[model samples]
Target: MSEVYDRLRGEIVDGTFETGAQLVELALAERYGTSRTPVREALRRLEQDGLVERGDRGMRVRTRSPEEILEIYEVRISLEATAASAAAQRHSEFDLIRIRRAQAAMDSTSTDDPAAMAAANRAVHEAIWVASHNGTIVDLLTRLNNHLTRYPATTLKVQGRWAEALDEHRALIDAIEQRDAARAHDLARDHMTKARDLRLQIYREDPTA
Candidate 1:
């Protein structure tokens, strides 16, 4: 059942099962080569994770509205800024190495490869969360990050967004490395605000966004 749950969740995150697509139990069971029982259990778990919801037709992937996406980012800005502040005070040399490595990966990734850019972006943010040394914040950010994967487009894929993001990340790392908690917090907050604005711009240009 856990295997079924993880595989289905991965597919949803990777955009294999798009938003609002129905996940019929028998279909998923056949796809996973598992019995209907495990498929049923997996769907239940995904529902708990806010990735799936019951609909008139059946269980479908959750489709977030533009308003909801904005609201999520607002919350993300708060949480992530706090995490950056904490990380500034708590991070060790190993944590800095992980963060720098992720940043370097993002820097090297071609702008044409949105998927790799998105993965690298995630790595950079996740490294900061781990550096915070706060289990509760890390767990909350992890859940928020999972919900973010449901979006059809990556913010990093927007024109010129990757370059801006790389610059913001570099500044953020510098603030953290200097143990400037206040500056780290402000930098993180501003970074998220810029990302939110860019994402909204992308959504305005594309109805599907």
Candidate 2:
């Protein structure tokens, strides 16, 4: 049952399950070669995570509006900036090495595939969050980022933006490496601000965003 829940949660976050779609318990059970019990339990957990919703009809995936996307980004900017600041103040040499590894992965994959870029982007931020040494911050970031995965990769898929995004990340890493908490905070904030604006633009272009 826990395994079922984990699998379903991963599919939902990675866009395999998608948003605004019905999650029929029996169907899911058959699809996963499991019984209805685990499927129902998984749906319950997904609902708690805000990844799914329940109504008189049944369970369905949650949908986000353009406004909701913007709000999520705004919240991310604030939280991630604080995390970056904390990471800068607390990070050790080992943390720096881990972050550099993630950054290198991002640099390599950002230009290749949307899925890889998304994974690498997540890794980089998670590394930073680990450096913060605040479990609360890490948990919040995990939840927020899980929600963020619902959005399309179109913003990051922009033609010239990948390189620019890598550069911004490099700048952020430089600040963190220097142990400049204020600079790391500001850079992370600005990075997310631009990402928010870009995503907003993407949503505007696609009303279904």
Candidate 3:
């Protein structure tokens, strides 16, 4: 049931299924080759995650407005900045290796596939969060980040931000490697700040967004 929910949730976040679309249980159950019971369970979980909402008509994919997106980004900046700071102060060598691997993957396919880039992007962030060794912060970041895929990739598509993002990743890794908590926190906050500005700009310009 959790797997089914995650699959549907991914589709919704990644825009494979657009916002406000009907999610009929029978159809989703058939498509996923599962019983309606799991699909129903997935839907319930989706509501808890804020990925879907119950309506008078039925279940509908939630739509994130520009303001809401900005608000989410703001919360992300605060939480993730602290995570990076904690990680820098506490990261193990093994954690640094995992972060490097994720960054390398991002650098490799960055131009080839946007979806893969996004996934790699997530991997890097999660690696840093895990390094912090604070389960509560990790849980908060997990929930806050789950909604980000709603933004069109156009923001990440911005010329050089993807590459710039890689540079930021490098800087973050460097801070963690050196165990410099202040630098890591500042770099992480700066990274999120830049992303927030660029994404908000893109959203304002995208009529379909």
* lDDT of the candidates, in the order given: 0.89, 0.85, 0.85
Clashes of 3: 0
lDDT of 3 at 156: 62
Which model, 1 or 2, shows the larger lDDT?
1
Error of 1 at 142 (Å): 1.0
* lDDT by residue (tens digit), candidate 1, 1-209: 99999999999987798879999999999999989999999998888777999999999999867797788898999999999999999999999999999998888988777788888899999999999999999988887776676775888877677888899999999999999999999999999998888777777887465
All candidates: TM-score: 0.91, 0.90, 0.88
Least accurate stretch of 10 residues (summed lDDT) in model 2? 146-155
lDDT of 2 by residue, 78-178 (tens): 98999999999999999999999999988778365777787788899899999999999898878877676677565678778778888988999999999
| Model 2 score (lDDT) | 0.85
Q: Could you tell me the TM-score of candidate 1?
A: 0.91
Could you arrange the candidates by lDDT from highest to lowest? 1, 3, 2
The C-alpha stretches of model 3 lying farther than 4 A from their native spots are 14-16, 26-35, 152-154, 207-209
lDDT of 3 by residue, 54-170 (tens): 777899887768888788988999988999999998888899889899888888874667777777888999999999999999998888776665665645678888889989999
